[model samples]
Target chain A: MPPEPDNIPDAGQAEEIAELVAKTPDTLPLKRPATPVFVPATLPDEPVEAPENGAALENPPVERPISVPQAESVPSQAVSVVAPVAPEPVSPPAVEFSPPPHQTFRASLTLELRCATPDASIRYALGAADVGEDGTLYDPAAKILLTQSTGIAARAWVNGESGPLALAHFEISQPQWEKKEPLDQSDATPHEISDQRALEGPWKLAAASVRGKLHAHRGGWREDAFAHDLAPAADGTYAIVVVSDGAGSAPLSRVGSNLLCRETLAHLRDALTQSAPLSTDAQELRERDLPLLRVVLVEAARHALQKLNEEAAKRARPLSDFASTLLILVRREWNGQQLCAALQAGDGAIALWNDDNTLTLLGMADHGENSGETRFITTVGMEAELPSRVRFSIRPNLHAVAAMTDGVADDYFPEATRLNQLFGAVLPLVENGDAPGAALLRWIQYEKKGSSDDRALTLCWRDDAAPQPETVTEETSDGHA
Target chain B: MTSQLISWKVRDLMTFPFLSQLGITFALSAAAMSDIPPPETAATEVAAPENSSSDGGAPELDASMRRLPVYLVLDCSGSMTGEPIEAVRQGMKTLLSELKSDPQALETVWMSVITFDSGANQVMPLTELLMVKEPSFEARGTTALGAALRLLLDQINQEVRKTTSTQKGDWKPLIFLMTDGEPTDQWEDAADAVKAARVGNFIACAAGSQANEATLKRMTDVVVRLNDLQPDALKQFFKWVSASVATTSMNIAKSDAPVGLPALPPEIVIVP
Candidate 1:
């Protein structure tokens, strides 16, 4: 076949010439004549052809020779045959496409024209070569569809001078998906997190969890969990909302997060039953309920920690293998006041979008010294700090309360301020939807660079106009709880 | 914010029809594999949708837009002349191309090229994969591996942002060092400093038969040796490096251990 790009030197000819030059000295009378003594060695063209396909290769490990297993009977002869000049490299590609052409997608390609020049306008023509500033003014929203193999050349037009012409060729082929399997089959978690919604009185509960794009790409587990139940409170029904983020490095963190959410709510329900009911009056409850609410929250958190340890012990896995972060809240509505008690460990946030129209981070977000570092529920002394971690609040005109794993929490990072942005976006999903759980799942997957982690969010709010409620909601109650 | 969220959702739901006419066609890339994929059709979600941005630039380029800084510290010594140097160039071309195609890497990966010859210099600054001007390479003088390490250290410290109360930091940096021979300069203390600082997730590559493995071990726990010095090995090596970048960028709030990278291609072997 003809070389498509004439500029590329023919590698086959180069290698042959290199072999001839290196062998000239070996053929002389002074050199050791050992290579012809061992008859079965094929030297000229085998190593060149051995790695015919990438699939045929697997790493034999470091500090070791290539496991090609050259004939050992006459090892020195093997070296002397082609020993002088080692295997040379194949020639470089004719033209180095700036970012090499990597993929051939089955479906059409979605192309985004980018100009790093801060305020440059990008213009492009689909079928042309180098469409400087003459194609069409680029719109960020109007998607550019490439349904066939096309050359897209775009340039940033700024200050009457064009930036380096950005050119790329996209190839379209039949649908192909690269699949990555979980390393351990027995430790596999669910592929998709199901939507769960519940309603009581004017109060509504919507909980959702979705595997992040990266995790989905890698066949990684949806390590986040969201669960809510209208467990019996002291005087009224309390909406117990919980969300946990499992450690990505942990082998069984998906199981751990799910277990922690269920146990914590269960333990909290039983613990709260024997407590004194504080006055439903908003002013009185704030003064009286603080001490009692803190204790019950810690007790529930401690029990959940113990459950993780027990589950870890049962599976014969390290405690760290079942590590996860926890965010749990128990809130009740009585008279006109809405009182909430939140317990958090690790980095996720428990925030209340209060009636006063301000976002309040109910508990502290604990990130250790590093960027990706955070304390897990299974961390030593986690329970010791549980009491101080609880935050109790009484909001008379409460709008909504949300509990989210760091997957969702970190997207709206520096959660102190950006949560209002998250809350503003989520309010529409809750108020104007029949399946808020499903909406929440889809809504949390908003495109953000470098923010790919399994997102789990639970939102509960009171809708005074939704003409009360019957007890006819699908109760996600397991008989054990 | 709501509009941004809705646009992404809308794109996810959109489907396309294949065009009958191929426009502006070119010959298959030299790196392109010849084998056709088996027609195994499964409703698998696109593994890399997260990499592409339907929107032009990341909004405000704020905290959530955490950068995955990738440093390529390469040895362009006299020994790396001719075929070896060209292979490095070819490998980088393929690596950068593959990274840009990946949406996540395109969106978040910022790469810097550092080369060492008689002395080390930052050939390219930390720039976004989408906007980076990949520099042309040449093989000139002795291997100054120590100067390369020290320069890499300084660049990382100066470039990588740290997470504070007000601003989010860049993800832990990934450093890939490719060398074809032993260092001619004093490199021991520099290598020790790289290990001691606990700066980046380092993966050193011994590029050819002349490449020294013991010298690389002092700089990093993860070291891989390039086999044969063939173009195929070089291609596979760059492919694995790109995937390693993707793997590190994918990991959010992970453990203390080195991030789990994809398995090495046959042309490379990990030093245990």
Candidate 2:
């Protein structure tokens, strides 16, 4: 193999070589032995008969002895093999025997990935290479140094007793950009704080609810409630909506509630990406799948909470100011089944109205005596700590699943009989009607008159024949007390 | 904002792929079987025999060992924008403060930071850590790990090799190479140079949440996986680096000639 384009040393090759050498701490003694470099001129003519192949002896034999002069340039032993000098050498045979100008050495490197368990851990075939032989992996080229190609070939196998069922092959190459620049001495010139708050409708402050009866008063901050519905997609995939109620005690609850919904959406997307597909077999046991899905949801919640903590820490604000209750609903269309999983940690309600008119309360808050009855699962010491368990799972072909903050549950689930009646009326509206979200808003408006809090509800229903809901919806104008 | 959220979602999806990539397999140790070096023990200075074979006839670049040479080969390409770049900047400030806290760094620890944008730039040269102020960096451009590596290797060979005539010191040098993206430029030449210079003199590590570990593994075979591009983690990494260098420099200051330097933590997984 001939030398590749990169291997051909040009005019500045030596300078480049010298710079490579200079990057090191020259204090450490370079143990380059004083042995003379040797380049083999050619093999001596022992007159050995050529084999039948004729391929081995294609080149004429000529030999050059190793002398002190030849050894000085290339001191390394790997490149120092030289043929013994031939005695009374006649004119060297035409350069037929000179070794090819350059021989490219290729080493087949394998990176195998073995998955110990399909759901657990995975290991790389080539764990870590000590290409530099030094304890520290200080060189960026170390990856290239170990593998033959500047690109390292890696293989991954999953579910081999270790973890997960997975296999993959990929190459790792060095960065094409330059190194990082040192920090500027100047103090960070503070920039304008990005107004990242997400809001619905016109008011910077507003409440979303199913009930529309409440109206605004003279000087109070509270006002009428509006219902905003997010329907299912064209592919029978309903959007999972979650409404988090900000703690009224903290001024930032409104902000935290909005952040919770936004962050939960982000987390749900992330979990879905990382989550393996749930086939029909898993869907059969949606009840059993709740535990695992719970862990995922709780983790997502914890992450969002941590982000809030970080924001507070950055601004030197107390953590409590950024606290809010999280209610999350996840729905997907998979394997000809619409799998809906709703999780409520702390104070929230998750209700499912089956197609058969039976209402199952998937989640409910601990409504105690305090005016703010239901409590968020936030403990004094456990900031961002994951809950012991999460409660959620897939529901196959349900009429609809609704998750609402405590404010709605308080006004809506006033009595067990009323709760059953409410489901009886609402499930049919969702099951029989063309527009379930509009129907839900009408029902909630009749049920509650005056409710002032960060109220929200997300209803997701899936049916092959259900009409596709538009992406955006018009906000309703029902006042709440 | 929605686009940002969508992109982040995509990034979240890549975590599995990224985790799979990190499942690297290679020999645990090449030279000898050793236990994980204890934190306290690794922090302590080890002395090599004054006339040990490895230390014999080692050329001293400077008459005085006070000048410490540190070459930072950083990734400042377009890929390392946003938090990654800002974290690096904050990390450098923390490193400077850490050095300032150490008396040895004040006397020694000459620093040079090299940034490879389209190509390698000597953003900062061999200035005394105490004297030189940190420079500003706005990361943007393609990654040229190869060119950057070659540039650092060359600078080390040229500038650090030319030592001062005042004191004969044989301090260990350090090189921290970090990037969050793959090499878009040709890297064969730099890889060859690194292979040639691996004589156990430098400590190189690559870091970044989005770094191409396989590429890093090839370059130095040693990769420290940073869980995030948080400023604190960077500070921790640099602190350890600075401590290791300062400790080694202290040893060199007390020695008459080259001595066996302390080893880095073995838990630091090396790329084979």
Candidate 3:
């Protein structure tokens, strides 16, 4: 058969070849033993017997004994039996075969032949053999020829002492080379997060938020909000970043979320300016300055609530209509160490990415028994709930810290392992060419399962040297509240 | 918003030929099953719903769409043996056929059927609408309304998934109870249980003259009474049900608010 285009090996091609070879017959009827067989050069003086069906024998008429070498040098055990029949036409009909389930097939043919003379080299040529060395004509020593073509007859010429003998009657049926895909071992395990981002130094603050697809489809406004301020403290060392998320059910929650962000940063700034500088030691800060931080958070919450109530009264609505969650992160460099303090309410997460490629959850989202239900900053007794929700930490090797609303939490903090892997993937992007917040916003919006919620994220990091503030802020306002 | 709502209603009224073009067969299973606890002298028969015979046998499920589970708790007492029972069957078929044509309804609705006679039995388990079959009903024995409510509560416990801290579960279930007569068996205890379950929505429907509207009112805030058992009236009620389901699916897909049920058909009187 003519050679067709060689197929590129797939995952299952090796298995198919093994199976085919196992199914192939080891010996054909024409294959002789390795022992040498001599043919007398001289024939009897009687009239040479003509083969049946008007075919004449092509044997040499020399009258001497000839020693035929053993067939031990043949690469294959199959012997080529030259028949004196006319070559069949090489139409090379296209054959289509369906493979079994989970299996793929390629067209091929297996040729078996035997040559009789010592120098009886069998040269087989397949039609259209342009598919490289593997698809071209077989060498003279090749007794078994395999080609990737079907339904075309192969022409084989045996060169011997008697001269070239053409045997072109050999026809091959298309072989269905079956291959099965390799079994995947990772099917039963949870997906492993891939972290390919390259981290560098000199990071800046970036924040972005997008309205959810479902909300946009319903013509609803983007209720989620966030704000980050990196003003230098009086001591010229600390910076503050505040983030918030508004309740989707509340019509005025967006106002509340934005107000809380500004008010929280303002309150923190006032408290830091009024108070005197304390010890730079981590233990001293935890023991002495922690209570002061708590007071700052409570005071900020009170001011934010007062502002929300004034707005609600101005509009003749209830305060509950402006429910929102808050997250406050304070960072300062003390004694060559990076320290962070955070306070959070409701379903959003804060993660700290350290220089050693480890992620620590500074604050996990506050979730209720029911999914999508969580505590809000506007709860009746948020002041009392503040102590448990506030978090403080100090890390000399900190790279970056991020705070995100529940929309991003669905993808980054669905579980502990995913949280770590996600932070690892994003921390490097903090120093990437794309603005960190824009990169994160793209990552968050990349069609994830159960992520159709308003997303707001704030990323904060300190550069090795003071550089121009690389601040990126993105917001989407559909104009309907 | 008004135009969108009107468009959806108009689409609901217009029937499409795609219903017949769909290759899925609506083969009802005669066997009854219950995921609920059995009452004394259980007469319920449990078997798999016809569509669940093989995973490959039914149409593919769209995993992206959240399921809006609907339970139809029907009363098959002796009072509804003739015309009433026929109307119920026709109404159910009409509901299925209309919902099959609405792409949103097909994507989000999951339905199950429970019938109470001497005792309650789940004739069909909670199944996706794409594979749902029109349930068969036969009026017989007494109206064991209490037992049916108990079965429904139990089924809700087993079938409906509640949200947890880490994973999101199935949406809250919507239940509709249609009965033609007052309960012959004790039902007050079961009514309290249903109320305590805090199901997303419970619409009690009293069909025909013999049904007790007062008793149904106690079971749910939304109560509609069908004064007469007629095919056309029942068809309107079923159309209303289909519209309500479609609206709820659309609402939940967009917002987290409680499902807003559409107004009842004019033929059915709403009990204040």
Candidate 4:
């Protein structure tokens, strides 16, 4: 006799499979090739009642007519009608019967499980770009108009050691207007661009050391290991480190990131070392030259991505398949004092770790809350449109800083909270004997794992150990969970 | 009894609420109360937002906004032989360049030039810096520095009046009386005019070796010893002037109101 039909509510595919197995009885003589296994026609027409344990089941079924397929075999259909056995245990019952010796038994099992996997990570190394040497990075993709008048180059690493990439050349074009009288503005120069003023004393120029790493996105485990140290000059000069990440989606992001770090260092050094008196004030410098530092850096990154794309395209690849972000750290020590500055653009975060367990954000992270989206500087153009770039400043009084891409930062933390976490993780290192950059890297890999995109960091520190001032005692809720 | 009553009246003025509203300090009230008077200490101790008292101390303007009165006295005289004439022309260019380096110089300095060859001629009238174009420097005959000096005194008076006309703050005017040779005309009257005005106002100085030291002695004792006629010295002098002007201007800018008198270098002598 055939076994009695057991009731099974429809859930999702998992539930349907479970129900089908439970409904099948072991009393009937099993058929050889065509066994009577129930093929669920659409999900059951009834709402799936919650399981006894209250675990979520399949979606509630919408009201609809149930259409069950009739059995092909008359014998099987008759057996079901003829057989009337006690209902199977409501809890779980297992029934097994040996298949006919002459018939071969075939079976298949299917189960479903849901798990969130980490994303792909892109680590950066270093790269550089020469303005006007190649095509001008003035197009929207480059987001800057660089000219020969303002000669500047930038370098940085994208993800880990893949780069020391070269960005496109960036420059500031000369003004159409010229001054006839020493400072008199000629009609050619139509308007004053910005307030002309120089930064005053109490504002310091110095260097700091920062360290950090990037967490891997699943299998693409990359490491961002870099270091920066600042030494004081008797002449009150400085050495700095500035890094820019290429769009992770770019083909040569690693190269771009590294290139940016090196080029920025080299350019700033060359510019300052030429013994050119820093236009004693900010106003003097602005008038004598263009405030193209920010734009130049962006353009350089874009250019690097472009060249890498071109090279990759020759090999049949999409540009920006591995682009990264950008960061800058500058240090100068003078008169027994240190002055430093750090800037970041894209998904990276910069933190200052102090001796008294204080942390500050040197760069900001982009949160999708404002517009439900986050944007980054990228090498690739969508329909020929480039992404935006950002700039920030830091100075001598800076204790220590860390710059890193999102890959190492926990996405669970809101932008503000993540920044706090970044500061928290790196602050102790700067305070401790640990090198700022190195400590930050370790924290990103070990402390902040299973996070977001690619990561990169750079740090600068003072050589002399002047006592740090007392830290502010105000408690802040700005830390990461 | 009368003096005591006067003191009480002065105290009332000091305590009056109206002074504070106008951003003014009542010195009488504070002076009466304090046993010791504060010396003119480096201007650093003075409150930044408030103006320093003019008694015994030069008006303390915010260092960033001080204006300068620069009287460009040119020697359109016979002794301005070929090289000196060319040097003077080139010197103006250098001054422009040096001044431009300092952003504050543009706003702080009011430039005027007096040419004295056969007679004193006002080549350029005192004008607000933001409005006037650079004046052309011309050269010609005999040195009539005395006449030029007279004109300078009159112009200084007019400028002081114009500055006070607005009830705005004032800065000491600087007269850079330059000459290539001795005065060919009688200068006693002009010298007396400068000396009289010099009592509590204006910095009158002579600029060349050919300048009559005796004649200048009658005008204020301030004399710029330009021992070197080289173009470089001229450049250095102008640079110093520019820096001084800028320093004062910066101080002036720090306050809401301008200072009444800018501090001057005690009779600056441009050494070779």
First chain TM-score in every candidate?
A: 0.63, 0.44, 0.53, 0.42
Off by over 4 Å in 2: A1-239, A282-292, A333-338, A377-386, A393-397, A414-417, A425-443, A447-454, A467-481, B1-272
For candidate 1, give fnat to 2 decimals: 0.22
Candidate with best DockQ: 1
What are the per-residue Cα lDDT tens digits for candidate 2 across B34-135? 222222321232221011111112223222123557777788888666656766766675566556554445445678899987788888776655444455
The clash count of every prediction, one per candidate, is: 7, 102, 5, 121
lDDT of 4 by residue, B138-240 (tens): 5678888789888887777665432121122234565666665777888788778778766222333455565655666677665555555555555555555
Q: Across residues A1-481, which tens digit of lDDT does each residue of candidate 2 receive?
A: 2232442345564454344334323322233224311111232223223234433234234332221111111121111111234312321211111111122212111121111111212121222211111212111111111222221112111111111111111222221112222143222211111111111111011123521111111111111111222233333333445566655445454456556666666766556555654534542334343445556667767777777777678868776665566666665654443455555555656665544443445553444321232345343543343343233323333555566665455444332212334444444455555555555555444422113233455555444353443333547678753
* Colliding residue pairs in candidate 3: A79-A113, A79-A114, A80-A113, A80-A114, B32-B45
lDDT per residue for candidate 1 within A2-121, as digits (tens), equals 223332335663464355344433432332233221111122221111233342123222221222112211111100112233322321111112222245733233444443333445
What is candidate 2's CA lDDT for residue A327? 69
Please name the candidate that would achieve the greatest TM-score relative to the true structure: 1
TM-score of candidate 3's chain B against its reference? Answer: 0.74
Give candidate 4's total backbone clashes: 121
Worst 10 residues of 1 chain B by lDDT: B1-10
Interface RMSD list for the candidates? 22.3, 33.6, 26.8, 33.6
User: Local distance difference test, per candidate?
Assistant: 0.65, 0.43, 0.55, 0.38
